[model samples]
Target: MFYDKVFFLGKILLHLSIIYFMIASNKIIYDRNNYSDKELISLYKKLVKPRLIEEKMLILLRQGKISKWFSGIGQEAIAVGVCNALSTDEYILPMHRNLGIFTSRNIPLHKLFAQWQGKKSGFTNGRDRSFHFGSQEFKIIGMISHLGPQLGVANGIALGNLLKNNNQVTTVFSGDGATSEGDFHEALNVAAVWNLPVLFCVENNGYGLSTPSSEQFKCKNIADKGVGYGMESYIIDGNNILEVHSKVLEIAQSVRVNPRPVLIEFKTFRMRGHEEASGNKYVPHNILELWALKDPIENYQNFLRKENILSEELEVLIKEEIVHEINEHLRIAFAEEEISSTTENEIAGVYKHIHFIEKKPNQNTTEARLVDAISNGLDKSLEVFDNLIVMGQDIAEYGGVFKVTEGFLKKYGKDRIRNTPICESSIIEAAYGLSINGFKSVVELQFSDFITSGFNPVINLLAKSFYRWNQPADIVLRMPCGAGVGAGPFHSQTNEAWFTKTPGLKVVYPAFPYDAKGLLATSIEDENPVLFFEHKALYRSIYQEIPEDYYTIPLGKAKLLNEGMDLTIIAYGLAVHWVLDEFKKHQFSADIIDLRTLQPLDVATIYKSVKKTGKVLIVQEDTLFGGIASDISALISENCFEYLDAPIKRIGSIETPIPFAKNLENLYLQNDMIIKEVNILLKY
Candidate 1:
């Protein structure tokens, strides 16, 4: 009981220290000689504007005008200092608390206010409020709620600049809490490996939401971890704007020329709560008072006054001017048209145009393995489009894990056939960076199941790219999927429904070498993010004569491999081949349909086949519940219900984890199960 009391007291003391120690130091002017007194005064006045605006936003929040408000109260110095050091063209991916960075970039206050008001003129056009907005023209990526992925995005932009030999750098900002994320380590590792020009700034506000740094990280300083990644690391007083600006500028200049990543940890405190929603309750009263005394804006204001740069009259005038400007912007924002999606016409159409560039192809066929055909398709794309690139682990010299990208390194060199660190999220986020910068990227996820590790980028960034902006991320994520051989649960899994269910993503799973080569060729050129799932079992197992010349099979079109009036067997990937073999064995007369792409599904072809056969059996290698088969079954029921002679039958892997044992694995994913289902459907 005594030990428990001591432990509880220790926990309380730890929390108290986190709040108090974060702002215990009063060091303000370190390297004040860099900025002139006049410039310092001007910077202080500019800083005051954001603080005042924040206060105004809080009032608006109370008035039910603004949906949310994330205050950067005491941490303004970090954003102002870092953004000041960056060039106009340099990219900045800021988190919610870095409002000063947006203000520093001179983004119109009216536009920002409109975004808060959910107006049509807003940055995200009312698609999102808060900080979920960015300016492509200004090179400022808006803060997504998740912070870690942006660092990888910054690394990608830096890589693009490096590839072009352009003397530009990218500065990405996150809080100390973000350092614990896998994406942070992944992004830093990639930046270090490539020697990309990226400045990663972490504002150590001592807490992640309500959790203190003592509990959040097991390190002394976030910057110290950068040393492990072979990056230049530094820690400084984040409250001192002059010190931050000078140090960041020095490193920024060196990085712009030499090209290397630098990690800077700014020791600061968040004076306010995490956001408006989180009331100031977690912090102890005494600690809040201590931090209030060390307020960044107030400290800087005192320094400016001491230097005789700011007078009483001037201070008053500046405050009045800033307040008036913000009020005007708010007034304009409130009067602007409110963005609404409730209208029938608007709700009916959300996705952009999707069409294949129709060009007649020569019927020249050449026998090739699926892997070789994919390589050929990539080679042709690289030859035709200079901006096209293939990136993944062991893709360069080792020629990928399955030898899919064999001879690519020798043919294209390191710049084109880029080798990456084993950072899955960064791999896809880097693809996003390249796509936004007018480059097409084909990323190979070593195995399909590994995509789970990088699901954030795939779902949030890649999938949302087209829907957010009409700009399609011209990226193809090549996932080597499916379980046939004994590569257990971690390595082998079919994940089609995961992507197909997602709205803005296109999923293509070709069954034949002909479709594999053609669909891949088109996916590279198409203006949409495509998840090209290459069946691991079929890469070397299947061989066919494919078109030697460049060709593209239309995406949303199914191929009829066999025709029969008795029943329809619809499948994709290796399932198509399995169903065909089973039919041959059983001597079953059935119409076989291979769905080349899962999303933007060829429902018309399925309806046609179901109508002709009067019976349908959907087969998939994915798990039974919530699989692609369920959707196909529903489509058949909805569209061709009258033509059905039997209730729709569907076969999929058993609803359980894929086992390492051969027997259990076979039982989990068996073609015999599908054959039995087909037999039942035929008899019905």
Candidate 2:
């Protein structure tokens, strides 16, 4: 009985010890009197510099020396506080108004001013302005004009850190207004699903552009939404730099090891309008006066005075030094020459020369259908590269709409082979994030026609990413396209021409099973972004012997199926088959050129054929207007005008959507249409 009493007492003591330790570890590390004086002074300087720089930039804007400025006049505390929490090597994806983050990172003041002036000394070398550029060396991601997409991108970066086993947490900033964008929820959901090491900081300045938070969200605090995604959420006084710093730092210390996302909503206000051009007319005067009373810099200065670390003379001296520093930087930035129109800096200058992959002899061959070949190609690529990942709707287990990814989930697991929500724009934006972090993503768009839903990321972000920042986005978008199976207009459309005209994109379309397998291999291995189109009709219909050993077909090179001198037929995708069928029946002595890749068109082969034949006929599956056929016809008229004996002729689907009726669908871009166009070229 005495031993039992001793054991009970020992157990009670152990429980008490654990509770004491827990309380000690989480004890508040700083208070009004206990905070370090040196650190407080440093934070004060960080808070002051951004305020002065913003005021100077406004002055320059009035002088017509800078184009525009987005002032973070009232929100300096959040920027400095969050940046102070991060380690030097940790990544930061910040918004334009977060100037304190830049100053804290030692981003030179001259370069910042030069960027605003559109000068050569800027980060983008006059290619962009106003926080649209990021430094790979500094671990910062350049911001796109669209704000919310960065949240999804931050998920990718944090996932990368997790994969690398690097115990580093990433912080991304967004305004309260951006939380309304779909990308915000999409990113938070993904990060929470994966349990990533990231902190999403929302500067809830009560207004987004001109809209107030009352209209922006139905909830009271943006932090309230974090719990829905299973993340820890908090609301803090943003005007108090000490409070913001303490909370972020404490959370950062925990998340780097435990590795789950946290959302901290900094309750602040935007002192200035959206830009200098927007002069605070939309904001209420009384609201501005209320926030001015809580100014972050003024509050910090008052705190410093209470601590006896700041004096009136000292404050004046510090301001004078910063003013002189700003003037010197501005003078140097202005003296820097503007970027000239050189070959390297011109439009389309971002595209590097195509390094074509070499062809190899086919060996260990196996006969396969077009779909099987494409599936095999993707399988081999995933097996070969650890960095390669694939994502799409119903791709994880359903194996995709056409079963192209049938067994990927079981083989690769859900991490690499992912199933995403029906948010098409976020899918591509996530891919861009993955690509920038040294991972290659092969994103599948279930149907080519659905690209309209994801067009903004393709045109605005993906197509322009390389040109703006010269970063390699190694992504391949697989689009199953074309008509002939009577799936109707929406599902059966051919949209290759839409991307072919878009710069910074490589478009590839193959006809046979062998070409499909080989070209997919090439696209996966290539460094640049490629839009790969596979015709649905050819998936099961076309069959051929494909090499078991991997080999890549060179991009921007054409295959001459048959050579002749009477006429030259130019075609690609499914149209190539129609031309081949018509030629065999008519017994025409024409050179048939199959353009396997469309972007960097194989002009040499086409020109050589046209020069010998002296007549041309272009065929396409897309509509007659704004299609590749029109571009090729114009090229022939300009380059081979003398070689051509007759005016260049082309044929395509009548400018109308494909109909659901069998007879009407058959009348569109069928073999008979090519035969009719071929007879005209033969007669000429």
Q: lDDT by residue for model 1 over 244-338, one digit each (tens)?
A: 88889999999988999999999888887888789779987876777777778888888777878888899999999999999998888888876
Model 2: which ten-residue window has the lowest total lDDT?
22-31
Task: Write candidate 2's Cα lDDT for 6-39 as tens digits.
Answer: 9999998987676566445433223554567778
* Candidate 2 runs further than 4 Å off: 1-34, 343-348, 352-362
RMSD of each: 4.6, 11.4
Model 1 TM-score relative to the real fold: 0.93
| Top candidate when judged by TM-score against the true structure | 1
**How displaced is residue 343 in candidate 2, in Å?**
4.9
Backbone steric clashes in candidate 1, count: 0
Question: lDDT per prediction?
Answer: 0.84, 0.85
Error of 2 at 553 (Å): 1.9
